[model samples]
Target: MEKKELEYIHSFAEYVDRFIRLLIDYSPKLVSALIILFVGLYVIRFINRLVRKIMVKRELDPTLSKFLADSLLWALRVLLFVTFISKLGIETSSFVAILGAAGLAIGLSLQGSLSNFAGGMLIILFKPFRVGDTIEAQGVVGTVLEIQIFVTKLITGNNQTIFVPNGILSNGVIINYSMQGNRRADLVFSLSYDTNIKTAKDIVMQVMLNHPKVLKNPAPTVTVRDLTDSAIHLSIKPWAKNVDFGDMSSDILENCKEAFDAAGIVTQPFVREASKG
Candidate 1:
């Protein structure tokens, strides 16, 4: 029993000695790896800042600049991490293979998200629309709030926030109302058939000219669009700055009604669709 106990003690001591020797052998490499990691992190941060400054100086779009900076920072950090691990005498080839496999699995699982990311890249590159532009897409009309890697945000006329995936948004038709800086208001008004077409047109034109927001260069047009059984259809089209489009359109409509009433012009209900005989 005594002999057995001595053997166990000797075995324990040998294990401890081996562990200490291993630590002694690896200590410098581990310390060096830690230092490299810290230095790499600092360098990455500095590079990120430098890239951002360069992007700003070049007047690049904010969304694209941020995305590029973040992607670059992450890739550099990953490379630094691999270097650190390799310094510790770990075989990086196997590590990289495992990472590749894992990335493949993750990519397969997140196909939709990857597609959105690609779409975001396309949007940033092509610049179909920018932030703060009023756009109509995916059956929703809204102001562009934010453009993200995976999704784009919009604020509707009713102030509803919508998060649309970039993948779908990129594929669909986007109507950018503010792109041209000016928009035309297409309004139709109906009056009794007895009302003079020329007089009604003159009144509408006068109201449009009086409005400060309406543009005069393009000129406001008021003409007889159609002659219906119940009323005369007049088309009132005016051009205004995109920013003031909604307000100018509403004001023009209200002012036209007031002017018509003052001029003793009668409004009439007309059937939009004619019955088939």
Candidate 2:
């Protein structure tokens, strides 16, 4: 054999030896890392199930409970990842620093979402409103159906669904009709000037008082509000529980119409004047 060929063979053997030694040295670390990963995953699942059970037992608010659970899950996952890396004999400080930097970048990029998350947390903490409450805010009046981390879902009177961002909802003015448990309805009725004011008042007042939903403590009131050229406007104010407000107002109006007609009290609906010929 030539001297060059022998040297080439010797070099190939040296490379193979180094490769085998490397495989032997690193195999245990790799296996340990894999084992740690699988075990960590199982523990995470177990912890998640336990937390869910605790939340159910405590009857915690669904949105807040979900947020807490997810936060815990991600934290555990990050810790597990760090442990897996360290088990593989890799330095963790630089990896941790990299993770921190990446997290900061992601936080900055998702500023709006983070703000919404914070708003949701505040809502859960302070409880300005809750699920199933009827509220009016940002020009939308509806019942709260669901409150999530970033957005809230509302179902309006006409059955239209609305999605309002938590950031806006928390920061803006919220009028929770259900919070106080009662609401006042302001209604106006028109009558011809020729109609007897006392009789008209009695008929409308009777209708409101007879209604089962109207609260007796506040008592319904009927007062002459304005004197127009064509008619007299009577302001009718009734207080009812929030749950009964809609039905009570509708019932009062309908019953008042029937009563007014029966008593010969004429309610004049104003009409727009026609253009002169």
Candidate 3:
């Protein structure tokens, strides 16, 4: 029994010695790896900040800038992790292969999401519209609230929130009404055939030109657009700042009605001619 106990103690000492030697052999490499990881992390953070500053200076879209910074940081950190593991004498080929396989599986499962991400990238690179801009697309007209990777948020005139997929939005036609600082208000008014066309045109033009919100540079125009059996159609076009478009148009329409009524100019409805047998 004493001999067995001595043998067990000797075996335990040998195990401890082997562990000490392994630790000594690996200690320097582990310390160096840790230092490299810390430095790499710091460098990555610095690069991310630098990139963000540059993006801000270049006036890149905020949403896109953040996405790019995060993606770059994650990629660099992943590379750093791989380097740290390799420094510890760990094989990385299999690790990278596993990551690749996992990425492939995720990609396959999120094909639609990937498409939206691509679409978002395209939108950021080539901006068709910006936040706060009024746009018409997907049979909806609304102001852009937020631009994101998967979807864009819009607030309609009726105050409804809509989430539009970036994939469809990027592919479809986007009518940005606020791209131009000024917008033209096209209004059509009909007067009775008995009312002089020239008089009606002059009245509408006077109202448009005298409006405070209408731009005077381009000059508002009121021209005879069509001559119907029961009425004379006049097209009134006035230019105004985009922000004041609604108010300007509404005021002009109301003013025209009041002015026509005061001048005894009657608005008439279109009358179709009877088909001859």
Candidate 4:
């Protein structure tokens, strides 16, 4: 029994020695890997900050810039992970293959979402329209409230809120009305054939020019548009600041009514909302 105990102690001692040797052999590798991980993370954060600063300097859209910075951060971290694994003698090629396969699977499963994400990136990058701009698309005309990564929010003239997915918006045609800074209103007036055409033209022109909001440089024009069996039609074209476009139409129509009544001119004038694309 004493001889067997001695043999057991010897065997335990040998196992301990082997463990010690193994630890010593791997300690340096483990320490280096840890150092790289910590340092790589720090470097990634620093780079992300630098990229964000650059984007700000370039005046990139705020939402788009943040998205780009986060994407770069994840890509860099993935590369650092590959390097970290390679440092520890892991088969990096096999790991990369696994990552690729996983990515492909995920991409397939979320193809619709990916398409929307891609569309969002394009819209933000190209800036076909911006928040606060009045736009017409998807059978809706409204002012843009927010431009987000997945959807754009709009407030319609009737005060209805709308959310449009980036995928459909980017693919469809958009009409931006505010980009021009000014809009033209076409007011049509129909007077009885007996009414003096020259008097009607002068009245409409005076109303458009005397208004404070209308642009004077273009010189408002009143011309005979069409003659029907019931009346003679005249088109009154005036330009005004985009912000005042809707108000301008209402005011012009009201003023024309008062003016014609006072002038003893019998006429009916109607205005159409400015159409733009």
Candidate 5:
């Protein structure tokens, strides 16, 4: 009986040894698959980082930077995931098809959002305006406070915050006031026709030259823009830094009035002609 028991144990051990050999023979394929997955994931992360660095170095806007980074990272992650799955002997074509169908559905549902995003890309690449720049678009005039993927925040002269869709802002005409670094301060002054036009012009020019904010290089211009029945029109064009626009405008007008008063030049007011007297 002892001899029979020994033989039984030897047979069981031989079966176990055969199973171990079979597993060892197949381990290389499993190890290769795991290695491929790990390497693919590492490459994806590295490529994503490289793309972000490149975009940031291009001096792109902050909002655009984030958008591009996320897009590139997502694309790389999807590619790595597909490669890893394929290494495990799984077909990726069906997975890709499903993802594509889902993406199409989501995109259709969020058409407005996608439009704004596309508009934002155009604005960023073209750079029509930037934050803190005063712009007039679609009849809305304000200083840009923030630029987002879908909307732009603007603070109007009256201190009200307005959110404008990027799609509309990008499609419409944009007039940027702060792009030139200086603004032309325009002032129109009218005097009685009896007043000497040349004298009035000299007084206006002198006032502009003496003002602190007026630029000296361009020189202020005082010209007769038009002649009205009741008044001689003088158009005063002064070049001033953007920061000094408000002060320079107010000072020029006030000084023109004072100088005209000192010179005894009487301002004239418009009068409508009586109809069919």
Candidate 6:
């Protein structure tokens, strides 16, 4: 029994000595790999923080700053990962080359999406339009909801959301409806052909002038714009603050009735074509 115990101890000692030697032999490589990994991670994190600080200091848009920071961090971390792999005695040159080639192929295949991404970057940097701004683009007019990396979201007056690619938005003409501070309201009123043209114009002009919300600085213009076969057409032009446009429009039509009654001017109904029986 004693000899058997001694043999067991001897076998255990051999096993411990082999493990120690193995650890020592590979210690330098393992230590170097660990140091490289930790330092790379630290540097990447520091640089990411630094970039965010600079972006905040520059007063970049929150969405844009977040996107840019994430993209930069991802790129840095990928590079660090490649370096870490190399430190572990892995030949990553071919791997990197393959990744680059694949990326290029994918990018080429998705040129439209890539263009949108680039255009989105330009939009964020240049800031042609911002969230909540009313704009007309790509035959869609709405308020901006979000400006993402590849697309812009808009909420229409009808409460519909639209996603427009940034490529078309940036490349095409964008009419910022809210940028001009004020908007012009143009409305046409048709009166009976026999009705007094002068009276009709006077009534419309008076209605516009009396409106409280209407801007008084730019005097409203009322004139006989066209003469149809059945009616005398009068055009009413007024300028009002953008925010007041809808309110003024709704009130103007209602006020015209009172003005016309006071002036004794009558309007005619539009006639529709009759189909052949």
Clash pairs for candidate 4: none
Q: Model 3, 18-99: lDDT tens per residue?
A: 9999999999999999999999999999999999999999998899999999999999999999999999999999999999
Error of 5 at 244 (Å): 1.6
Measured against the true structure, the TM-scores of the candidates, in listed sequence, are 0.93, 0.86, 0.87, 0.83, 0.76, 0.83
**Per-residue lDDT of model 1, residues 158-234, tens digit only:** 88999999999999999999899988888888898778888999999999999999999799898888787887888
Worst 10 residues of 4 by lDDT: 268-277
* Highest TM-score against the true fold, candidate: 1
* Superposition-based RMSD of candidate 6 using all C-alpha atoms, in angstroms: 5.7
lDDT of 6 by residue, 1-277 (tens): 6999999999999999999999998788779988988998899899999999999999989889999899999999898888877887789989899999999999999999999999999889898999988998999999999999999999998999999999999999998878877877777777777677776777778788888878887888888767877777777777788888888977887788667767677766541212211
Off by over 4 Å in 1: 270-277
What alpha-carbon RMSD in Å does predicted model 2 have with respect to the real structure? 5.2
- In candidate 1 the C-alpha lDDT for residue 223 amounts to 81
Q: Which pairs, if any, clash in model 3? A: none
Model 5 scores a C-alpha lDDT of 0.84
| Clash pairs (backbone) in predicted model 6 | none
Model 5, position 171, has a per-residue lDDT of 91
Between 4 and 6, whose lDDT is larger? 4
TM-score (C-alpha, index-matched) for candidate 3 = 0.87
Over 4 Å off in model 6, which ranges? 1-23, 270-277
Candidate 6: residue 19 Cα off by (Å): 8.9
Q: What lDDT, from 0 to 1, does candidate 1 have?
A: 0.90
Stretches of candidate 5 exceeding 4 Å from the true structure = 1-46, 84-91, 268-277
Better of 1 and 6 by lDDT: 1
What CA root-mean-square deviation does each model show from the true structure? 3.4, 5.2, 4.9, 3.7, 7.7, 5.7
The lDDT ranking, best first, is 1, 3, 2, 4, 6, 5
Which should have the higher lDDT, number 5 or number 6? Answer: 6
Give the Å shift of residue 131 in candidate 5: 2.6
